[model samples]
Target: MAAKKNILLIIADDLGRNLGVCGESKIKTPNLDDLAAQGTYFDMAFASTASCSGSRSVIQSGLHTHETGQLGLLRGFQGLHYFTTFDHVETSPKVFNSLGYLTGIINKVHVGPAECYPWRVREESSTRDVAWTAQRSAAFFERAKEEDKPFFLTVGYIDPHRDLTRGGFGNTQDYPGVEHLPYDPKDVTIPFFLSDVPEVRQELAEYYSAVWRMDQGVGMLLQELHRAGLDESTLVMFTSDNGPPFVNSKSTLYDAGVRLPMIIRTPGCTPGIVNPNLVSFIDILPTFLNWAGFANVKGNRKGRSVLSIMSETSPLDDWGQVFGSHTFHELTAYYPTRYMRTKRFKYHRNVAWQLDFPFPGDLYGAVSWEGMRNAEPAMIGKRPVANYIKRGPEELFDLENDPEEVHNLANDPEYNETLLDMRKALEAWQLETEDPWFFRDGISTRVIFNHIDAGMKMPDRWDFDVNSPGSKDGAIMPHSFKEVRGRGAM
Candidate 1:
């Protein structure tokens, strides 16, 4: 029989496509670049949400934020307590532990309920010190070796993330072997998502330095793995919780936010293959469970493992679309938006488009934000601040043509057929996932199902009033998901 493979999942905080392998040559990421070369690099991977705690929760629970009940940051978002997954949601740690893997997390476990994530070794260090994390992870590996058990260790590096202060990125301290000054403000490429200003450039410089330190940490961990004679038996995956900490990124669900990197070095797989599969954070748990021999995968874990097609160069039939769900970032940033992104088109349903979008605590006070707000153009990249904050209820974008998502074609008669098709597909997904955000007449269908079951006639148009769209020719009746699940929604 083959030896069971160990899992080393390294999650970088607030990192975007800054690595060279991801086509960002300005911000050097040698460790990640080499790791991508050593295994399959998924080109189109996404997070269920764009916030830190919410994304990590999705990674662990293998479910969307709507299903997991992680509506916002899990803890200490501006010293205000937030929420976590329900106790019933089985987290990655809990599953791997019960299935006989020695589960341990080195830093930044932003999930909840001890029973859900019963980590055998949990070190809740919020340190950006990579060496300490590397040493701790190695020690955990040694313990697993000592007990003759396969292991699952997560090294959550808090580098490249914003510090408590407005423009800080935890880069004030000198590291042992990392380059103290990785890049200059003029050298680092300003992402298309941010404005070109002094504050934004300087912040990117600091952010680059922090990412450099995090890469050093990655190199150290890989070195430890090699030294411990576990290189051939371990599956190493490197990913980020969300996009970079920028004004237009991080907390929003644009491609800059929800779309992130997924690099995996599975044992005995063909190296240097670029898999174009559309994957998600929810797939992580299923992949681990697949490695750990846990079967009977059903219910709310609405994701399949990437193990079957990790090295496939071309996109598969079923790997073409992904869903995104977001409710809040802090306790206050409650702009609920759900999206369905296919290979070419993206559709968004902004549940709270009536209210202005709230910014996360850090982004609100960011220097980049301040610069853009006061700039002559007053833009976050090419997007107007007004259009960003006050979004439309429905939006449709042709990602192949408008990669930046600058245009909304929902109301355009030319794309009406395409828009309705994508909307139906998204609604069908909501029904299958039991998403509570599926609305009718400004109310959750699930929330008002009792009234519907008791024969309350309702306007069938989505979340509309009397004079709104499709209210005149209303398909008014008692609602049923089985009836509403539209055709071609497969």
Candidate 2:
């Protein structure tokens, strides 16, 4: 048998199909471009969820976001009752650790609220400093070499995730020469829903700068691997946790929120191949396990191994449908939205309330960390909130025609059959995965406040109405009708 391959999975935060290899001309991602040239790139790959916690949950568990019950980004929510990626359940990493592989994680390893199991070793560190990503990753590899064990190393980079409250690139200075890149707001393409204002353009520029910095980090790590004589033996994979962080991107069920860039480089394996088959983030766990030769690690992981597809030995019939969803954010009760994507189309089903501001009354959405405080005053009233509350119960898009998801065709009489077929498939998947939202009660609630009170008098026009489902007061209430469940307490 061939010597066991070492696995290195590198994840970038909030990345999309906007890389140079993906035909994006404005951004500079040469490092990733080179990696894609040497590896197999999946053009239709998608994240199981849009937010950090949700997508990470899928990566660790090999289960859909609904299956893990971690559909939202909140630290604590109703989804905790189910199994997680790190749980001692059948699909835990212990299966691989038991097989004599040393598994270690660096940077953001948000694998749910479950306490760390005894199987895997984790080197926790702050990834805010982009320079440390490669350095720390190299350190982990050196440790693995000393132990003389084949390893699975996961490196998480927080770059390109929206910058801190300042709005500039977080670690761009570390990747010198990034500033020299063409910073043209005109080159930035705003999403269909968001206005193409100067503020949005400036935000895109900063976002591109961060992407350039992350590419530098990748180059640094690849150099270290090659220097240590591990490049040929290591199976390196580069991907993103979710899509870009924008108004209709991260939290929505649209393609912009879930589609990710996935590249895998294996020695003596196929190179420079692009597979347009549908692949989900949930497949990562099983793919890693299968590649490590632990085909039956523990339980039945939900994903199929893409190794066959990567090698070009398997036919296209082996590929299957992919699903994604989202639940919580800020302190608002955004309705749960689930998605089912095939090769040519994507269907989004909005369960619970169909509010316009999906996460209404959530303080975080209003406060754009970069010192911009709810600049749009028109979004603070009842009509807007109510309108958001009554949005589409279902939405469908033809990827070939409307890749940007500009129009919703679920209600169109011509495509009723397609909508029904997708909905049926979505319902079946939810039922099989045992999603909690399928059994939940009435719509979730979120309480908005007029003014935060640090140490001053409450707002004079404070309004309170229990029956209205949403309130504007000094304190924001949880979305639950009975009582707020987890974490967010007034």
Instruction: Name the top lDDT candidate.
Output: 1
* Model 2 CA deviation exceeding 4 Å by range: 74-92, 114-120, 171-182, 191-194, 311-315, 318-320, 330-333, 359-390, 439-490
Tell me the deviation in Å of residue 264 in model 2.
0.9
Give me the overall lDDT of model 2: 0.67
Local accuracy of candidate 1 as per-residue lDDT tens digits, 1-490: 7586799999999999888888988877888999999998989999989998889889888899988888788787467757778788878887777778899998888777656778999998888888888888889889999998999998899988999888999988775655665578998787888889888998899899988888989999999998888998898989999999887789889999988989989778889988888998888888877765664654558888898897799989999999989988888678889998888998999987899988888888988789889999899888999888889989999988898888999999999999999998898888777778888878788766555655666677566674654444545454365543332121
Distance from true location, Cα of 362 in model 1, Å: 0.4
The lDDT of each candidate is 0.85, 0.67
TM-scores of all models?
0.94, 0.79
All-Cα superposition RMSD per candidate: 3.5, 10.5
Q: Count clashing pairs, candidate 1.
A: 2
Compose the digit string of candidate 2's lDDT tens values, residues 1-490.
5686788889888887779888888888999999998989888788877777668767777877656656556343334333233344443445567778888777766565535333266766545555576777788778778888888887888777765443455644444333335477778865543444566677778778788878888888898888777987788889998777765566666777788799999887777888878888878888888888777764646787788788552337557578877765433545677889987778987765435545422224323222222345332111232233355767788878877665678889998999999987887676565455542224222121112212222222212224654323433322122322332422
